[model samples]
Structure formats: structure tokens, C-alpha cells
Target: MSRCVLLRCAAAAAVVAATLVAAACGGDDTPTDVVLVTHDSFAVSKAVKQAFERESGLTLRILQGGDANEVLNRSLLTAGDPQGDVVFGIDDSVLSRAVGGDLLEEYRSPELSTVEPDFANPDPHVTPIDHGEVCLNVDRRWFASRHVPPPKTLADLILDRYRNLLVVENPATSSPGLAFLLATVATYGDPGWQTYWRGLRANGVRVVDGWEEAYTQQFSGASGSPGKRPIVVSYASSPAAEVIFASKPLATAPTAAVEEGCYRQVEYAGVLRGAHNEDGARKLIDFMLSERFQADVPGSMFVYPVRAGVPLPEAFAKHAIVPRDPLQLPAAQVDANRDRWVARWTEIVVR
Candidate 1:
């Protein structure tokens, strides 16, 4: 294995994010200390953080690192001792494992009314915070230049002309990577996904470690120079992000999403089981699901708001689309099959 491959296989480090605590000012015991544990993708502006603090009287400290599974694993493995007051960014793919650890405190926020029932944590162990669409992304200019129509379906990718033009992140180490793998499972049931993957392997596919490398290193549109690969396994909103981050603003993005096989990934937030302050922790969870926080999701986390009626920013609103019939698998079922899926996927495609 190459050095990069070994790095991708290494166990993820524990991530810590956001701290809040109760601080005494004058005679009132104000809620001041609250710790938020999240992955590196989680983001919030200073103004938003200040709004949360003013609204709830809590000081925030964010500790962050690792993939979603490792974050949840570190939380579960040390459940007896515990770290941080709340945990966010556990997607449904790993939802079952987080629940299995019994490290979640139940606080069925009335906010469940605002979230889609399918994504709501029925056990009340966690609350869906936001969602993202895992879709195939293509470099519009690259394909247009080659006169090769961008693939509209996953199967279209196996055409001889398109060999090695697609890049996928390794599922074991990246959060979106896991979602993309689950998407295939949802689209092609049981052993069917393995068959589909074998066909792709015969066509020659490229796999990377994470979205950062896939998008920035491998995707032709974002590599700062032309890349050999044009398609990537990434969030649907990446095209818009590319436009926003470009050196010269383009009227339209150079990339687009193939929604046919897209997967819906719902991110969740919850109070860690051994939280020091249940009251403050519940308040934090509620805060995340509130309208103000939902409105902040797009720019804050580059994810769609879970709560209905939250208007998105122009950049995202213009390019991102929620796919119809986007693939979904039950969290419990995913938890049960995760290890098997990885083994089968690696067996078929990692050669």
C-alpha cells in the first residue's frame, strides 16, 4: 500500500469542539460552560455563536477532529468516563453504533415536529440537526470540452470512454464516503451492490481517502490546474462552493450534480450520556434545532437546514437540489451491516 493509503487506513483521532459553562456574575448563577463535540466539517460563525450565547447564556468551546464513526467510537469507548456535554455530526449510517453504546441522553425536543419523521431519532437518543445530499459531481467544462456528455446515471459511468474519470473517497475514513457506500447498497440491494461495483472495477475507477483530496486534488474543476479525473463522490452543494471560492466569479458553476443515485445523509445532535449539565445540554440541542440555528446551517455547516421554512443562501439555493427518491437505509439496518459492507466493498474495489 502507498503511504497515503496507509494514512487513510489509520484509526481517526478523537475530535473535541465547543465548550460552555455556568459562570457566576453578580448574584445570578448564569449558564456559561457547555462543550460541543463535533467533526471538522461542523462550522458556525462568531456572530451565530454569540447569538447562541446571548440567547442561552452559555459560553461555547469547540473541540474537533476525526471522521464521524471515530468521533462516535471515542465517545462510546469512553462512555464510562465521558467527554464534552453534547455531540453533533453523527449521521444515520453510524446511528446504530452510537445508540448501542447507550451514551445518549433522551431529550425528545418538541422540535421533532419540524424535522422529517424518517430522520427523527425515534429512540429520542439523538435529534436530527441537518442534512446533506451525497451525489455524483462532474466538471461541466471538462466534459463539454471532451464532447462527452456528463453521466446521468451511475451505470453510465462504466462506459469505456469514462474509465478512471471518477474519484470516490474511502468509506472507512470519511463521513461522506460512508454515505456514498450506503447509497449504493440502497440502490442495489444486498449482493447487488457488489455486482455493480465489480463492473466498475473492470472499467477502472479511482478512489481517494476523503472529500478534501477527492475535490481539491483529484476533481479537475478544483485542482487549481486540470485534473485527469472529473467526477467525484461528494455533496451536491460542492459546485456552488466552487463558484464561491473561485478566483474569478463565474456566472455559473463549472460542475453539476447527477441526482439519480444521490443519497440523503441526516446529521444528528445529542447530549452525551454522562453530561455534567443536562439542563444546559438540552438547551444546546434545542438551540441547534431552532429557527435561528437552522437558518445558519447553509453557510455555517454547508448543509441543508432540517427545519422547514429556513431560507437558504443565494449561492446554495441556486445550485443545490434535493433529489427525489434519494437512497436511504434504516440506521439500525446500516449499523448491523456496516462491517460486512466495508469488507465486501474493499474486497471488490480496493484491488
Candidate 2:
């Protein structure tokens, strides 16, 4: 299947109401089922689910809460009285909010020893599962066809030649959008970041509500609905995904990531406070960090595993570009300034 088709199918699945699938018996009142609350983008193989069910003996129920911010907000609203036993896909940009809301119980996974120390945060309440770069993905054919060199850096997007050729999601609504916004903040610093956004706005940068629209609708590399914009704010792993999910085997990906100024987004999963199935939640977290799940991550969700020594799929090994100096902000700093920065971004870029 093509990337477009797969994404459409995933999106369809995300929109459907949450469902319950009962697991094997673990006695009457011991809570044999655990609910996992996550953003719409989460995906894993059936084998992984089966393994978890077979080993932990807990039925996994998933609740997809729109997007990352929406997931965080929903989890926050039900913090102590959580609707789900576990919460996943909370990225560094919003981790502090989850921490501040007191939504998670402090439980360190033993699997942490296997995770790369750089990806590990000091917080015991959350465990890193996967990480990916939010960067500019360019349709190589589009640029080559136009005889225009693809922009290599974030600042290059504002150049006159690249004007009206870029589409980005809204920082207020999307995780990658917020990560890109923070990238600018980290790249340019306070007032300078505001100036950079103004430049982008003046250069006719297109903004959408989410990644789905930006990648599937407005991106020129999309299968059927080809668009004018060649540069999109998307994951560094996206090109590898394109290669892996192509309708036919190809020599190379049609798209590639612009490495400079990319922002790293690390996703973490945690046991929710007051969960009915605390043991099950902790088991789920450990399972996420296990070699089986880590190996499944690249092809399944198109994100690099946090656990070291997990082999990358061939497509990822060849096509994905891990940024040498990806932009980053401390979780506390991001938490402190996220709202103000997003609001300022709206004032400068959206309004």
C-alpha cells in the first residue's frame, strides 16, 4: 500500500470510538484489563499486542484523544481519576504540563538501563519510548523539476525562492508544529524568534491545523492529490516511511529530511495516577521499552526506539537522517514558555 493509503486508514481508525477487547481471565476483581490513553498517531503491531497480552495477561484498551495537546489536556482533566490506566505520546514539549498536573505516578521502569542516557529524562514519572526529529521534509522531485535547490536550513525557508512552497501545522494544535516552534525559539532565542516568524509570515508560509492535512493534502509528494508546497513540517523518519510503504519497491525515497535546525521530539509513556490497574500499567511501560517493542517501533510508528541496540529497519538505516545537532529546550523551559510562545506565534504567524 502507498503511504497515503496507510495514513488514511490509520486516520480512519483513529476517528472511530474506542473499543474494549477482553483478555484472558486473571480472577474476578483484580482488574484484568488496562486502558491506554494516547494520541491518534500511536501504532504498534498486532504481534506486540499479543505478546503483551500473553505475558502480562491484561487486555489492552486504547482511547485515542485527537492530537498530542488534546491527549495531554484530556489526561490532565482526569488526572487523579483517570479514564485510562496509562498515558502515552506525551512529548518533551508538553511533559512539564503532565508533571505539573500531577497526572502520573512515579514508577521507574527497569528497562531504563537499556535506553540511551541522552534520551532519558530525570523524571521517574515518565519513561521514554521513542524519539524522532521534526524537520522540513522536501519533495525531491518537485525541487529538481523546478530547478531550485532544496532549502538546507530552517532559515532558508524564508528566502524568496522558497516562499509559498512550505506548509506547516499550527503550533497551537499539533505536536510537530509546537516542536518546530520551539526549534525556532531555541535557534533564534526570545525576540529573535518572533522576528523569524514574522519573516516566514511575510514570505507566505502556509499553516494548517494538523499534520494530516499538511502531509496528505498540501504536500506535493502525496500520492494522488499533488499540491504546490514541496516543503512540509514533518518527521525525519517520514522519508523512510515513504520508502517502506511505497506501492512498489523503489531505489530511494522520493523525499528527504533537511537535517539542519531539526527539533527532536521524544515521546514518553507513564502509569496514570489512581489507575485501577497500576501493575498492568507498569507492565505496559516495560513492554514498550523491551527489545521486541523497540524493534517494532521504526516500521510501525516511524520513530527511533529509545532503547539502545535496537536495529533500524533497512529503509530507516539508509534514508532517515538523525540530526547531528537537533534543536532542544529543557522540559521545564518549554513548559514555562509554551503558552506564551504559541500565543506570540499566533499573533505573528497566524493572525
Candidate 3:
């Protein structure tokens, strides 16, 4: 099926499920199953799900609610009659809104003790599962063939030499785009971010709607067909993913992330406020933070585990460079100013 058709079908299913959940909330027909509502990117091994169900004695259901923003918005809209028992993929960019809306029930997991102290939940409403860096991925061959040096910093993107060589996702539509925008805001501050974006626009930076198009279609690094743009806004782990998914295993990645422009994104999972199976929801959250799940994270999700001592896949350890000081804005600041920033960004960059 076509991608648009698939998205439409998924959306229709979500709406129908939401209606059923609303009816269940109004009546006595509470669901016995523990439903996990998450973004399209969420994944877990079948073994993991089976183990959770076997131990918890509750049927597990997963709902892919479009994207991170969509999933969070759906949970907020259905706060008291949530479509699922647990919600995952709420990142730092949207966490404050979820907390402020009272969409989640506070349940601190005991498994958190093994997670890194830096990622510890400051608020009990949500628990961090995995983290990744949003950064610029460069096509090594693209620059090497031309004997041109790759841009090293955000400032380098707007240089005359780099014109028409970069592609970025739309902040209003793409998670990585939003994260990258936030990175600029954190790096350059409010007024400077607008200036930087204007410079990029003048330098011929192309903006696409989402990561898949930006990476697979426009990015010369990954596109199997003829591609133009050499630099794409993507994940630090993207290089590792390229190596892991290659048809014939690659000794090294063809793409590399520019660590200087990286933005840290931490994804969280929380029990919905009025879930039918709160105990099971809590168990699911705990399981996500467990060693077994953390071990599965790198290969399955291409993200770093939040658990302190979990070993990374060899591909990630060798190819991905975790930024020592990734740019980040406070959750409250992002929550308060996100819409305005996105709007201004649209005006400057998209228009």
C-alpha cells in the first residue's frame, strides 16, 4: 500500500479505538488488556511482550498513534478516558505539556535504580526509557568526491560553499526537525536562532515534511537512487543503523553525524491517568527500564539505553559519537515557546 493510504488507515483505526475507549469509560465494560499507545517508532521484541504478558497476566495491545506529537495530543485529549493504559514516546520536547495536562499517573518504577542518575525522573509522572541525539548526518563520499570539507558546526551550514547541499525536516511536522530547531535555540538563544535560520534559508537549505523523505529520498548518504542533498538532519545512531541494516554487512558506516550540532532527545513512558489496567501499566513501565529491554534497545530502536551499564551494539559503539554536551532547552521553556518558535521558523524557513 501507499504510505499516505497506510497513514490514513492507521488514523482511522486510532479514531475507532478512541471511540470504543470513550464508551468503555462511560459504562462498566472496562478493558482487561493493557494497551500501550506509542508513536510509530516504538518497537519491542516478541519475546519481551510475551514475557511481560506471561508474568503480568494481562493481554498486551499496542497502538501506533502516528507520531510523538500526535500520541501525546491524543493522550491529552483522552485524559480521563485514555485509549491505552500506558503511553510511550513522550520526549523532552513535549513532556511538560503532558505533565501540565495531568495526562499521566505518577508511578516511580523500582527498576529506575539501575538507570543512570542523569536520566532519573525528576517528576514521578514519567520514566525515561531511551535517549538519542538529533544531528547532521554527512555523506562521506559526497564531500570527498568533490574534495570539499564537510561542515563541522551549525554556523558552517550557511557558508557559500555549502549552499544547496543541505536538507532538513519541517519543525512543525518532524520530530528530528523540532529537536534540531530546539538545538539551535539552545545554542544561539532566541533572537539568534531566527537569524541563523534566515541565513540557512538564504543558503538554499531544503525543508521536507519528515525524516524518511529527508534521509531516504533527499539525503545522498542513504538514497539508493540519484540524490542531491549531502547533509541531512538525522540521528547520531543513524550511522550505526546504516551499518546494521546493510544488505551485506558493512565494516563501517557510509554516513557520519556531526557531533557539534547534536540535540539530545530523551523518550519517556508513563501510565495514563485513568487506565483500565493501572497495575499492568506500571509493570510495563518497569519492564521498559529492565536490563532485558535495555539490552534489546540498541538493535531494535537505534537509541541509547537509559540504564547505566547496558552494553551498546558494536555498530553503535564504533560508529555513533554521543555528544558530550548536546544542546537542550529546559522542558518548561520548550513547552511555553514551542508553538511560537515553530511558527516563526515556518515563516523564516518554510516560506
Candidate 4:
């Protein structure tokens, strides 16, 4: 071929290649992607995330903060143009803030029928996924060896010889810590709860900023610690964690639950009003609420599914305890009174 003809052929080839690449890269306008923002405790296996990708035909991205309150607060402050398409793991403790910020779309999931009505809050903003009782966690062997009796009741923590040895997370930063605080208010009215905290403070309690630090740094034989405080705040299902994460199969968990003032905390999911893919976000929420997901929840997240009829594994069925009357102060009341209550609590303890 002559030089001029060869040069023309190369030029045509370059034009075709550019056209093909344009088509591959979305041609003119491709669908925008979305993100799901949640806390670290939130769990979903690779299979579930893949199913969402395949079914929704859009990429699923996750934006995680250290915990639900952190993610929720950030989302709330940026609601008009959120960083994620959906926000999850918010519970009654943070629902008021979420609602106050108008961060959620008015999404009434059709799957709500699968869950118990009480847990599903009648309002159409958020949907409950899983629930657990927040209770005192005790290392059974530690107490047994020391011959120091573990606290058996809310009152016991203040009066019993176990007083100074307790480790707790700060309510503003820890989910379970906040739930337990709410429980005290429910178990004893506001002023009475204040009185109780004053007593607890006098008894020499140690408070940390979050649950992970309190549990692992201060509590005895936690996941990565060599500490000695026998009592901590965690889910009642923590005993099963010992069996599941244990180095070997054991007869029973090394820990036991102190159930007297257990506070029930239920987690929820909501579609962000700014979602780039609204229907896809709704579908993901539906998938989370499905029976298959609920059944796996106990072992994966250490919580009971709110979806009715989902059977728990033998471990949860055998070990998880139900409080005679789990405490709950309605979300509305909690929101209305939290500032005053927390202030009063701080004055009694920190001052």
C-alpha cells in the first residue's frame, strides 16, 4: 500500500476505536450509582450484596461510620445532598434526630407486613430489622474466683460490693450505653433515675467513651484484652459469641447475662430522600427484611429478627434470655426529655 493510503486507513481505525470506547463508557448518560451508609455492627454477607447488585442493575457502594449514631448524625447534617442513598442501623435512641432532620423518605415498605407491628413503628419513615436486649455482661469465672458477687439488678450495681468494679460506656457515644440509660429512666422516673446515677457514681464506676473500648479495654478476657472489670454492657446474646468465636468448642460460654434491667434496642433502615436510585434503595431494604436474611441474623449479628416466623439457630434459642418486662421509654418521650435527663445525669456523675 502507498504511504498516503496507509495513513488514511489508520485515521479511520482511530475514529472507530474512539466511538466504541464511548459506547462502553456509558455512551452519553449512564445511571448514577448509590451508597448505603451504616454502622460497623451492621452485617450482610457477600452473597447478599451481590444479589443486590445483580437484581438492581446498579453498583452498591457502602459508606460506614464507626457506629450508627455517627453515620446518622452526619447524614442528618447533610440531608439535602447526602453522601449515601440509604441510611441504616438507627434505633429508637436516634430516631428523633433522624426524623427531626428529615433525612428519611416516607417509605412504607410492603415487607412491613412480615414484621410485628409494635416493632415496626406505625409511622412510614423507618423499618425495624433486628432487636436485642441490652443487659449487663459478666465474666462468670472472674466473679467466681474473686468471690465478689456480680450485680443482679439495677439497684445492685450501686449497693452491692461489686460497685467500684463496673465498667460502662458513655451514653452519648455508645448504643447499649444509651439504651441502658433509657432503661433506668423507664425503670425509675426522671428524678429517681438521677438519684440512682448519683448513687452509682458514689460507688466508684468507671465510664468510657464507647462500648468497644469499655468491653475490650476494661472488661475481663474480652476479644483482645487483659483487664479485670467483671461487668460490662452488651447484648444478652454475647454468651453465644463465646461459643461461635471460641478457639474450640466448649460446654458453655464463659460469661453469663445479668438480666434485671435489660433494655430492648431495635435497629432500623431507611431510604435517603436524596437516593440516586430510589426504587433500588427500596428493594435493598425489602431484601434485608426478607425471611432468608432474618434467619441468618441471629448468628451473624447476634440479634433476633423482627420478622415474625424466622427461626433462630439452636445456640440463640438455647442461651438468649427474655426479660420478664424489657424496658422501653417511647421514642417521642426519650427525644423530648433526653437533653434534660442527660444533663442531670452528667451533673450527678461528672461533677
Each prediction's TM-score versus the true structure: 0.89, 0.91, 0.90, 0.88
Model with the higher lDDT, candidate 2 or 4 = 2
Q: Give the clash count for model 4.
A: 0
Q: How are the candidates ranked when ordered by TM-score, highest leading?
A: 2, 3, 1, 4
Local lDDT at 327 for model 2: 88
Give the range of the ten consecutive residues with the poorest summed lDDT in model 4: 23-32
Task: Give candidate 2's root-mean-square deviation (CA, Å).
Answer: 9.6
Steric overlap count per candidate: 19, 0, 0, 0
lDDT value for model 4: 0.80
Q: What is the descending lDDT order?
A: 3, 2, 1, 4
Please report, in order, the local distance difference test score of every candidate based on alpha carbons: 0.81, 0.88, 0.90, 0.80
Task: Give the per-residue lDDT of model 1 (tens digit) for 1-351.
Answer: 998877655623211111212132222444456788888788988888888899877777787857677788888887846678899988878888887888887789987788665565466788888989999999888899989899998888788888988888888777788888888888889989899888788887888888888888888877384567888898888777877777897788888988999999888888888876577788888888888889988887778888877888888878767787788898789988999999889988996
TM-score of 4: 0.88
Candidate 2: list runs displaced more than 4 Å.
Answer: 1-27
Pull out the clashing pairs in model 3: none
Candidate 4 per-residue C-alpha lDDT over 1-351 given as tens digits, one digit per residue, 9 for 90 to 100: 999999999999999988865553355445445577898887777776677677767677778888887888788788968877778898887788888888989888888888976676545888888888999989888888888777788888887587677888788777888888898899888678888887888888888888878877898946556867888888788877776777877677788788899999888888887876677678878878888778878877888888988887777766667566788888899889887877777777777
Better of 2 and 4 by TM-score: 2
- Candidate 2 per-residue lDDT, tens place, 184-243, comes to 999999979999999999999999998989999999976554577999999999888888
